[model samples]
Target: MTTLASVVSCLSDYDPNALPVAQAQAIMRDFVQPVSGVARVPVRSALDRVLAEDVLSSIDVPSHDNSAMDGFAFASAELASAAGEVSLRVIGTAYAGVAFDGAPTAGEAVRVMTGAVMPAGCDTVIPQEFTQGDANTVRFARDAVRAGDNRRLRGEDLARGSAALSAGRTLRPADIGLLASLGIAEVSVRRKLRVAFFSTGDELRSIGEPLDAGCVYDSNRYTLHAMLSRLGVELLDMGVVRDDPAALETAFRTAAENADAIITSGGVSVGEADFTKQMMAKLGDVTFWKIAMRPGRPMAFGRITSDGPNSQGAFLFGLPGNPVAVMVTFYHFVRGALLRMMGATDAGAPLVPAVSATPIRKRPGRTEYQRAIAALNDRGQLEVRLTGQQGSGVLRSMSEANCFVVLAHEQGHVNAGDTVQVLLFDGLV
Candidate 1:
């Protein structure tokens, strides 16, 4: 286990109060350990779950040579000896899931549908569109198709005992189809990660509750739920924990005991009067940080543990209270860390390049993620522009935008037509 102290001691410039965004990300990445447990699930049930082990094929995919499409299966030998256009007498029709009766001779052919097993001696197929004649007599130019064209050989997709899917893959819909193709009814996958989350503040209220003079409705939990759900982690919504030290500690303990990770919004900033910080300090190894990034400067990261014999433990992410900042920090930092915790091998998406449509003011020392709309212009050039006001509390901007225009830590002001990198909302999809 890598202790928090050990990890920090290695970094010469480690400053919790003014940590660089990338440095904070690196610390969390090094600290988290993937939870250990495997579940045997049906292929369909394994979608979005991480594979526990590499899946070896029990049998060859397709099992035999098959036609790639509706075509005339024939031996390619006579085509090479022919002078010009070639013709063959069709012996029989071959439909999908059914094989032709016997091998076609030197100049004979079989009308084969898509996925039909190729005849014993046929090594090539001429698509029906390329052939000129009807079923009884198939004719086409001699040069239309070459040897072994349009024929899918046995074990072409996956050979018996070969690896069909590697370990640590986050299964997708296509992966399920592939498993089904291999006749794999079940798979061993990492169990879904349980993430317990809540909002910590004295002035936050849930929906349907009467608004007090100083309190606003708590939208952080809802956003957190949606964001965490997208990662396929099972969520424990602990609702709003009061600013009291005892309540905060209880929430922290319960979350650590039951979940793989504890995500809380608010009460991590330096000026918050709540005992959340004190409770965190009394818990397991936790570190408070003011990351060098816009909107989401104040945050916390580490692990917390429960008390007594059970003594369950979980990684903790204390995000900022602002609605936009919560989402921004989650995407930039926590999302990747949680993926590592679940044993997923996917490294997420890369930021795409786009030309800025307008000038933007920026400084050199901090990274900024301005919610922006990116689209292709008339010349098919990608262009990005900010979504109205860029306030951290302005959740509407996040709603209206499609991507974040990421300005680097050392990047200065951006002028119109200057290129910038964008993190698209649909990159995962």
Candidate 2:
């Protein structure tokens, strides 16, 4: 129910003319709320889904103290009095699913396979490679292993009754395996968020349509579809709405009716032909901001009310039109907000520090996200170099770069070898 007026009234020094990047982010954080819908899904099907509740371990992870390696297990006391080497008689062999029932005397050892429960009274394991002889008897160097080594203690990975995963966590492959280890066949997770998006431009045409002299194919919709698909949201692509007030209004209303959030590329900037701005004002209390950021300075954000039978309202994000600007704005702004809507509790993507290979011209008032290639230098340290083209319209720049070199709002010019923050495009997904 938060309107632009209410958000602005709360700020002491609010400036609609040129808002800071942090201020815009703060507005979004204060306005958006996570969805409350929940569902029970199989653990394997919960990958990338936000956990609805904390997962507690029903039993110990290993369920018993086991050998961490294929080795001979014996009491640590047996090696205490050893001078040059420790020798012990092998009592019996224990496989992964089996255990040695008989207790081992001080001079006796038990052959234990990896994941096999430790033999009774055994507290250490010497890998077969470190010991000489067969299951009958084994001898190892006195300093081969420390006392109480190579034995995985029961409940060490996850103790029974302890929280295995916290609420709001996005389940990954490792998390799924951990849940399986704890005998969790199903988990409660938040439902996937539905996002409706479209492009606003009269000169844009779909791929199958014939290209006019002044019109180009609408690449923004395809890119948006790809990007949004990667985020695991249910996407409702409303296609390209021509630059007409009536058409734009219909598209906006339809998006608001069907989606939790709506994204549109183009028509937010100061342009004579931009009917999107006028129509957006009539439909909702959205605010158009010229943010202190490079490439994507103009953006529109707010909630739009829908009057359809099943419709209530939806969050709106009007991004810039340039091919690269759409992606830059999405990653920097829309991505985090969408994640919040999906009920994910991740703070944000981590910034990596790297040495700049070339000097960068920058001002102190605007944040810049320059596409760059980050790689290891001769010293095996991460170093970044700018992509060939820095133009916002050059979609190739995004394709050529592995990361975005982020220059903060207050940052000045950067010299070569200067350390800078880089947000990687790959990994950590």
Candidate 3:
């Protein structure tokens, strides 16, 4: 049986660039791939795209100091020594988008509406609701207003030349609103990564096709396509390729010429009919071909370099044929690599802590990633229970599970109530 130690040694000694998970991640981290340069897109179409450059404010957000309420703008000294009743002459009126023609003098005030620019020499504002008004004058009930009350200062939201959006920030709805507030009509963002995906095997068929006696409808392609769509990736569906080497090679050549990355589910294991490994050896250098985790032990990573005029290169990930294994390995490895290629500096799987609800027995060698349903207990702590079976082919078990209860490489049988690390599929998928 392949053990975790054997797997680690094989991967570490395979090549200078191929190593254990940590080492591979470190190498990927150090090799910085340039983000595809920005494209000018309408603000409406820029949602979720990473900002290619910092956005500096071209003008103050509000543009001018304005009134925050429908009130009166007046000199503070006019009401400084007033009794319970204070009166002032109405000099002018101001509304949103219309500034007062002149400044208010010592004993006068201007009727200002919300968002109206404050008149010069006006230092205070009293809400109209709190004042007694007539044709030409208004009276305050008391000295309840303070200097600079009910005013939106110029540059309060954002100042000219201030950084409004930093580089590498993924735009969201609020970011769009902020940009709209600043009158920005367009933005520069990174283009989406184009990924080519397919499934291979003679035993697989499309969902609508008549199923042969032993063949099953392919599900991994749909699942992977959905996940990649949610990540904003442009997808090239290569469809299903049969187990013949010529067909597989044609698919690989097309993907290598067109896509940034090629992902295939199935045909990377130790079986004699596993033609993916054979083709990989002939077409590119297999960086690594096995992992130390269960359900996804037969994972392959390699690069296909072009040998023709107008040549280009691409990365390939060959996943095990089992439906559950395909999902597991994609989350653990392929997703991170894709995120890096998209210029995300801190992309990786998230590990969460959960307590076991039952005992789990396993050999003390290979790491176990058991399908589990995780829920919050009465005490609001995370508790996980294993799915029905642990077979790699148990796709239903994984579909019903919300998390993976992880057992370390050296861990043996775990007792009930033992604390373990659980990776939730919610965020990752």
Candidate 4:
């Protein structure tokens, strides 16, 4: 039988195109099915949450024909005889919450404010700025106000029964306002995917803890937590787990039982102390162990199965220990998987093409993601410059980068000013 280490070693020898980034994403999405269910959440708690079903407008957005400006509401024919200026009787006044209730006569208009329903017979509104107004009379300027000017018709913003938002749309502030306008107090949103994450290895310590000779502060868990939080996931922080098998097993069991997915950094590689892979085999089936990529080559994915009466299956992702590698794999692998599980029909990191600001060297075997600081050049074109170093453990470089300049497996040695594809971190770093 091929050992896991040998399997990973063989992956580097395969053609990178054989398992292209797109194809790898498709495979992972296809393999790990979404947890099947929905939950109704209050609108107040729905921000940044994905909808499980389409949200239809319960009522017309404006609900009724109303005024868009605080001005005079009048019949269109009243201004016909006025060559340079027109004057009309202001029959009554209308505020935002109150309407004139009576229609305007041929030469009579109503004083209307913004958001007030237009009177029955009024078809136009001249702004108060464009009109001379007294206690009960208003005068218009030389310009003819168009019919329906300043009037917001009912259902203009959204028609009743129309889809206000499609399923799988991550709600934004504007979306929330739209929902409120339609009087939807609650929404059917997919339950936030519960992700339990942690970092492993005896050499890792939490921040503010005393650092020993060989130990480094745990940064992956916090980074992953922040990224997952931005995605609106329910994070179950398992803190830092040690390299021992018993501790690993306990963490795995707890995560599998409670979370929809579990993510861990380090110990998935070929080291002898890497007990994560071993624990996974004993508890869950390893779906695919490795991929052809730099800094994140030892990433793994699988499903944890259970046998209890209410046993639920959960997806698992193991990332490399290095801070930069953890970030790369999360964006490339974990984010895509989470999106798919949340019912996203289309989900992947956006790769934008940009010009290289300087030369970058690489071999043609492993696909490399170089941390780059991007800025628009003098011509208003996006240009990317590499950070100081490209090492996997360089957290400082990753912190300084706004995007990754993606160099393909077959592409070797790029000179300055070459066009390259860049994957922007998109404010998630």
Q: How well is each residue in 52-156 modelled by candidate 1, as lDDT tens digits?
A: 999999998879999998989988896887778888999998888877788888779999999999888888999999988875898899888888899998999
Arrange candidates by lDDT, highest first: which order? 1, 2, 4, 3
Off by over 4 Å in 4: 1-18, 77-89, 131-145, 270-274, 306-310, 344-355, 362-367, 376-383, 407-422, 427-429
Tens digits of per-residue lDDT for model 4 on 194-287?
8989899889999899999998889899899888988888889998998889999888888888889999999877664758888887888664
What is the C-alpha lDDT profile of model 3 across 100-217, one tens digit per residue? 9999776789999999999998877899999987958988866678767888888998999999988777787999999998889999888788789899888889988999999899
Best by lDDT: 1
lDDT of 2 by residue, 66-111 (tens): 9999999999998788988998998899899977779988799999
TM-scores of the models, in the order given: 0.97, 0.97, 0.74, 0.83
* Candidate-wise lDDT, in order: 0.91, 0.90, 0.79, 0.81
Error of 4 at 127 (Å): 3.0
State the TM-score for model 1: 0.97
In the order shown, the candidates' Cα RMSDs to the true structure are: 1.5, 1.3, 6.0, 4.7
Off by over 4 Å in 1: none
Worst 10 residues of 2 by lDDT: 1-10
The model with the greater lDDT, 2 or 3, is 2
Error of 2 at 65 (Å): 0.2
The candidate, 1 or 3, that scores higher on TM-score is 1
Model 3, residue 231: what's the lDDT? 71
Identify the runs in model 3 with alpha carbons over 4 angstroms from their true place.
1-20, 27-38, 65-153, 308-310, 345-390, 401-427
